[model samples]
Target: MDKIINWGILGCGNIANKFATDLQTVSGSVLRAVAAQDLDRAQNFAKKHTVERAYSNYTTLVNNPDLDVIYVATTHNFHYEHAALCLAANKAVLCEKPICVNAQEARKLVELSREKDIFLMEAMWTRFLPAVIRLKKDLDSGIIGTPQLVQADFGITKPQEAGSRFYENKLAAGALLDLGIYTINFANIVFGSHPERISGYAQFTNQGVDQLSTYNLLYSEGRQALLSAAVALPTPHQARIYGDKGRIVIDDFYHPQQYQIILNGKKPQQVDEIFDGFGYLYEAREVQQCLLGGKTESMICSLDETVAIMQVMDDLRKQWGLRYPNEN
Candidate 1:
C-alpha cells in the first residue's frame, strides 16, 4: 500500500479555502494542518476543512514533522517568503501560480529546493486537468496540424479599491500576475517553447499596478500568441488556437470543461471533461505522486518552466514600468 501523504496549508485566504476544500478529494492524502496570520482565521479554516491542526504562525505550521508537504496559498508578494520558509524547514512545497514576483526570486527558491532535495512544484492546476491532458495528446497527435496563432484572454471585474488584494500594489496586485499567467501558461502549453520576442501594453491603476494588460508573443517561424488579462475590464475569457490545417476553441481557457475542434476538410468535434472538487485536486494528486515516487519536482509543471514563465512576466512588467514594492 502507498504511504498516506500528509499535507499542510500556509495562509488561509480565498485561494487557500478552495485548495483545502478540493484537497479532501485527493486519495491517500490528509489535510494535517493549516496556518494563517490570524489565529481565528486558522482555527476557522481548520474546522471547516476538518484538518487535524491549526496555527497562527507559519513557522509553527512548517515545523510540524507530520506534514509531508505544504501548499503556499498567500498573495503574490508573500509567495517567495512563505515558500522559502517552508523549504528552509525541509518541507516540500506546492506554491500558488506565478510562483514569485519575479524570476530572480523564483530561481532562488528553485535552487533551495534542489539543494534540499525536496519535492516542490507550482500548483498549475490546469496542467493536470483531464481536458488539458486530452488537449495536449490531441495536439501532439497532429490534430491541429502545426499550431500557428494562439489567442487567449482571462479577465475578472473587480472593484478598483486599493484596500482589496486586487488593487493593492503592496500585495503585488496586477492583472498580469493574477490572471495573465493563465493566458501565458496556456500559450506555453500550446507552443511548448518560449517566445523569441515579447511585447506588452498595460492600463495602470491609481495604485500603480496594472488594471489590464495585453501581451503579444512572437515565436520562431512566425508562430504567435495574442493574450490579455484584466481586473477592471471585462472580456469573454476565451481562447483560440489556429493551425495550418485546423483550429480549436476553448470557452474558458483558465479552467476549461469543454472545447471545440475544427479541422480542414473534416467535421467540427466537441470535447468535454468533468472533474470534481473545483479542479485543484488534480495538482494535489500530482504532488502526492511526486512525494511517493521520491521525486523532487514534476515534469508537467517543472521549476524551470515556472522560473521561465516568471521571467517572461518580469520582462513584460519592466516594459510597462511596473515594479512591486520589494524589487530593485
Candidate 2:
C-alpha cells in the first residue's frame, strides 16, 4: 500500500486553495489542514476545501504530527520565514516560486533544509508540466538541434490597489517576482545554465512596484533569451524556443496545455496535454514521489538549481536598483 502523504498548507490564499483542490487529484496526497493569519478565513477555507482542520497559527499547522509535509503558499515576502518554520519542525516543504524575495534568503532556506535532512523544492510548476516534460525529452533527443534562444512573456492586468501585495514594495510585489520568474525559468531550462550577461529595464508604478519589465540574457556562443512581464497589461503569455534546426512554440506557456515543435523541412509536430482540474497536481505528484522514495530534494527541480535561479534574480534586482523594504 502506498503511504499517504498528509499535507499542511500555510497561508489560505488563492494559490493555497488551488493546491488544496489539486490534492484531490493526486493518489497519495491529502490536504489534512490549512493555516492562515485570520482564523475565520482559515475555517472558511477548510470548509471550502473539505480539509479536516484549520489553524490561525502557522506553527501549530507545521507541528501537526499527522502531516508529512507542508506547502508554503504565502506571498513572496513570507516564503523564507514560513518555510524556515516548517523546516525547523522537520517538515518537508514545497515553496512557491521565487522561493524567497532574494537569493540570500534562498540560500538560508536551502542550507536549513539540508541541515534538517528535510525535503525542499521550489514549486516551479512549469518545470513539471506534461508538455514541458515532453519538451525536455524531445530537446534532449536532438529534435531541436541546439537550443540557441528562448522568448516568453507573462502579463496580467491587475488593479493598482494600495494594500494589495501586487503593488506593494514592502510585500515584494512586482511583475518580476510574480510573472517574470516564469520567463527566467524557461530561459534557464532552454539554455541549461545561467546567462553570462543580463541586461534589463522596468517601468515602475507610483506605488514603487514594477508595472512592466523586459530583459535580455546573453549566453556563451552567442545564445540569448529575450523576455518580458507586466502587471498592468495582458500579453499573449506565449513562449518560443529557437534552435539551430527548429523552433518550439508554447501558447500560454506558464501553464501550458499544448506545444508544437517546428522542425526544418517538416510539418509542425504538436502535442496537447489534457488533465483534470488545476495544473498544480504535477508538482504535488513530484513531492509525493520524493517522499515515497525517501528523497530530500526534487530531481526535477533541485535545490541547487533554485539557488542558482534565485542568484540570477538577485543580480537583476541589484542592477535595476530594486530593493524591497524588508531587505537592507
TM-scores of the candidates in the order shown: 0.98, 0.97
lDDT of 1 by residue, 241-320 (tens): 99988899998888888899999888989999877779999999999999999999999999888998999999999999
Assess candidate 2 and give its lDDT: 0.90
Local error of candidate 1 at 30, Å?
Answer: 0.1
Screening candidate 2 with a backbone cut-off below 3 angstroms (N, C-alpha, C), the clashing residue pairs are none
Cα-lDDT of candidate 1? 0.92
Worst 10 residues of 2 by lDDT: 269-278
Q: Model 2 over residues 166-235: C-alpha lDDT tens digits? A: 8899889999998999998888887777888988898998877788989899988989999999999999
Give the best candidate by lDDT: 1
* Alpha-carbon local distance difference test for all models: 0.92, 0.90
Best by TM-score: 1
